[model samples]
Target: MQSTVNYLWHTDDLLGQGATASVYKARNKKSGELVAVKVFNTASYLRPREVQVREFEVLRKLNHQNIVKLFAVEETGGSRQKVLVMEYCSSGSLLSVLESPENAFGLPEEEFLVVLRCVAHVNALSGPKDSLPPKVSPRHEAVPGQRASSPLSAVAGMNHLRENGIVHRDIKPGNILRLLGEEGQSIYKLTDFGAARELDDDEKFVSVYGTEEYLHPDMYERAVLRKPQQKTFGVTVDLWSIGVTLYHAATGSLPFVPFGGPRRNKEMMYRITTEKPAGAIAGTQKEENGPLEWSYTLPVTCRLSLGLQSQLVPILANILEVEQAKCWGFDQFFAETSDILQRVIVHVFSLSQAVLHHVYIHAHNTIAIFLEAVYEQTRVAPQHQKFLFEGHFWVLEPNLSAQHIAHTTASSPLTLLSTASETPKGLAFKDPAQDIPKFFPKVDLQADYTTAKSVLGAGYQALWLARTLLAGQELMLRGLYWCVETFQATCRRTLEVTRMALLFLSSSLGTERFSSVAGMTEMQELKKVTELRSRLRALAEALSRCSHSITESQTSLSNLRSELLKNRDQVHADRSIQQIQYCLDKMNLIYKQFKKSRMRPGLGYNEEQIHKLDKVNFSRLAKRLLQLFQETCVQKYQTSLVTHGRWMREVHETRNHLRMVGCSVAAYNTEAQGAQESLSKILDQVSHQLLQDRTREAQVSPPLTAPYPSPALTDLVLQMQELCEEMKLLAFDLQDNNRVIEGLSRPPSAPDS
Candidate 1:
């Protein structure tokens, strides 16, 4: 027995006991590495060899960082009692961490995050590194066929085992070991394979095996195993066990109560089959062919806050998906876990900031209310001599509450800071009957309330207002965008009334309205009305302020779009030009060859040869010139229109602004209409004059019968030349029209200009 232990380990020590094995810690005799050895008890070894083989295969193939390692297996004396050697985890099980009183189970949040990240990484790398290599690596490999497709894979670590016909019938928190590495941090490892089994086993071993707290309802399914195996057990049963484990981690206790009966097995079976699972009892198993109530498992006592509870509740529900098909696969599990973790981080940060803001503001508002009450009750005070020079006589004496103002001999300024509403003792200052109403006007109160509601509803708008209040120009542009959107959403028209409202709101954020009681009430009513109407004039003013930037952004976007289109067109134009040039070059080359051929035939002096060469060369030159002229005209027109349109839009927007400021829309309209009429008149006159000139030329130019060409061909050539000249003239006229449009559309200048 000592030799057998030496063969497996260079060093060894007894650790503890399992249901069927005596566990030991050891260092590899060959490699000087740590491992665990399980010497199976005689009674369990007599049951089946297949159980041991299944456990061995499952552990060997699982090979995840989160899973405990099974190193080697051997038999002792006879094959009746076998021993399994696995990796030794120094940190021990989670149960030890939770149960030990020295460093209580209150794990640090950072520690929890580390565990989550480690589990996620392991799940992602679950499969073999590659298909070509049969040997598996200790490190996770994202090889094909090994990929887990869900975020829940971190919680449910079954893939290869299920595929190979093995099941970890018992999975629980105690079975999960925390291996300490490098620092004091604990790395989780799933251990204890004694109660696991294979699907193909024919032996008549009892199915009820896992710890009571972590067992699945399937135990009841197995109880009627003699009914000819009506249902086939699958991977989901293991997931149910994992769900129970997570519940224990979160609430620090079992979700269900233990059972009691005369016969332990019969009672356990009855409890599993009949009891309504705890409200928080979650796992990957769904009730099929049976009725079962689903809910959250209740805590034994009050534990965490609602927010913290909310953070973990959704995660529990996802792990406890009832339908097997809908259950999280490895890929989905990893993605979801990453997403939830990120959200949780953000929420925690935001909640902290919000709580701070709430506390500070609440204190400030309470103090302001208390001060106002004190000032109302006071008629005179020691500060009256100072008030004579300062001009405002309504200062609340230090430590003055309303109750004190009504009764005490003297008031304190601090009295105003309390939540009490009555006048404070001996509070003496400016009397309410003399001037309180005048200072705290009713209109101011109403305005304040309305402004608050509007600003609150318009979060983005409020942010813009805050930026302005802080005197930030860069943020103002962003604020303006929100303001404009808000105003547009609220108002029916963009006009002076809306612009003025925004202008005022931008400067003071409607704080003036709340300086008095009346204004506060009025403002509140106004806010509710405005919210219902979805209208606010300040938004328009905000938009107008941001107009320059908005216009610029729009112009930039348009220019970019235009430039892209222009580039595409230029490419097409270049291609066309190249094709035309190629054709022209080919024709020119052909013409030269034709001339050479013509010249070679007759000692270079024949009239027909000279005439043929001259005609072909002229035709080639004319085609090249015409193509160049047409392309030039197209490019010039396209370029001019794109450039002019930007200026035109700017002018048009300015004109609209002027119309809003009470300028006559008709005046602007008249100018545009006049420009259009003038352009049309000029085009008509040019057309008529061109026609007259053509007629005169037709009458006076000599009939084309020169250079020995036929009269008909000569006339046709002259007509074609005239057509080209007319088209060129039209291109120039179009340029003139573009300039006219630019002038007409430009915004009006200042009166001084």
Candidate 2:
């Protein structure tokens, strides 16, 4: 790399090259810190010195983080080049970031707000007499009788060239550097003041300089009219450039193309003065069967919130206004945007936390209820003479009478006394006393419940910690949705056996042997079974109701989704039509303005005005102006029609995606309805079996020991258990579908202004 070696600093890398200078990454030999050194060719002598001195004055006085800091200047080498040592922005320029594919969405909205604040700060500092460098004269260094204005008044004043103070003649993305701060946040610094100059109070600034694409409309008028002496621009010209730069940074393209064909300059000037720049509307475009497009050549603002659009559009328009009086001052721009910036910052930071908290509470409660049901089923002892526990062979020792053994043996080869070894591999029953305790170890049922609850609570707390790092609200909500579904699935698996056990208990309660037992213990056990049966029936009924609601919601959401798509298409169509009408109206206004202000070279000019305007052709200029107006109107009208068609198609595709989501929801509802029906039937069958057993018990003699549940009851329990397991899985589906429908149905929150 070409290096610039000074007494205190030595360059190690060439950072960039420009027309007037080459920038290098240099290190201070004394401090060993990296810096940028701009080496300018000073062979032209006075011109380079003046520009360097003016820039040095500005940089030396600026203490703000948003403006580049100057270290020292040295005249070095045989060629008499001036080397400016400055702060090194390691991350390079904002322009580089904007052009990178990684930042296709443009800079974050927060960063744009930061840039606006920086601009406002710069304007504020420039207005104050004390803020200017001690040795440098202020542009409006008061004439003998002129009174000094307040700082606010001075900042807002743009009518008088001298009163408006420092205007950065060249403001563009490439001139803004992005420094990486200690916190890893980007710090933007405005640089390159080579084109800057002080203005006199006696006259307006007449210089036609700065980047052409960012040049003010008044500057264009002056240039095109070839009457620099007749009109001048003030600090509003800098505001105009600021608007162009902001637009380019946000959208990745210039509002006006300053360079093009042979007649590009004239065309650009005409458009700047009389037409709205492309990409000013913030939306994406689509064409039927064609590639997706943008209303503008480059559109970075697509999908941005409406509140941001509302603020940005007017601010940009006011800055780029043809009339300087209509242009916004820094104060006005700040007032218009500060509330919006604050709201956006808050919304961006708080949304994820809100969504996560909401999901956690619901998931935690559902899991708690599910675990309780599993604990209840496992803890209770079986009342039957023969029962299966954890797929193990078990016979109630006290209840296994000769009659129970005969009944069990008659129904299957396995008798009531069948050993665990006799059971099939997969069907071998686990000892409930041992195996069940392993899953819930505490001797006290309450203690086991408490322990499980604490662990679950801790897990949720850990989830909250992890959620702090998540970026977006929508992603967090989706993640929470999955978590809830997973928990529901686990609950369903655990509850499968519990539901069957409850059904068997209900069936046994109606038997003569159970009802005729001559003790309070039997009656209490019967009462407990009766209550459990009621609760199970109620639960099934509730699930059936939930399934019904889910089906209805899915249908409603499908309709709402279709309506939203239609409404969006209609809104886009209306906007396009309105824009076309606006263009035609503007064209007519331009025509009227042109007719009233058409130049009459001989009749209107005073001696000096005529002499200064000698080369101008007023008649030809009017004809060309009319031709340009016609062309601009035609272009805008055609673009609007294309944009309208694209929006309609885009909306159609969006609706199709929503339709697919609705179909998936409908499929889930179908499965959920089947599960709900199965559960209801299981409840009804148990109720009927209990009633039959009660009638039989009243007609027969009481048994000495509790009779074994009939083979029919065992079969019914097993079947109900299987159905409950299926219901558990179906419940998960129903829950997930419900959440999806809710998400689709919920209206979007309006962006805070």
lDDT (0 to 1) per candidate: 0.40, 0.44
Model 2 segments more than 4 A misplaced? 1-12, 43-52, 123-165, 198-203, 221-229, 258-266, 277-303, 344-753
- TM match of model 1 to true structure: 0.37
Q: Each prediction's TM-score against the native? A: 0.37, 0.42
lDDT of 2 by residue, 168-247 (tens): 77777788888877888777777887766665432356667676556776675665545445666665567777777777
**Count of backbone clashes, every candidate in sequence:** 77, 7
The sequence of per-residue lDDT tens digits that candidate 1 reaches over residues 1-753 is 332543453224667776677787765666777777777777665666776566666666666677788777766544535667787888777666544321221233445444455444443223212213222222222324443334434434434443444555566767777877787767887677665655542223345666654554545445433333444444445555655555555544444433332134444343433454323442211233233334563342212323334444555554455444444443444444454343212111011001100000111122233333223323222232111001111233344322222211111111111111222121011111121011112223233233322222222222222222222211112222222232232122223332333343243223322123223233233334333112223333344544443344444435544543554454334443344344445444444443354434333347445545544454444344344434443333334334334433433343344334322222222332343233334334433444555456667774485434345434433543443343344334434433433333232221220
In terms of lDDT, model 1 sits at 0.40
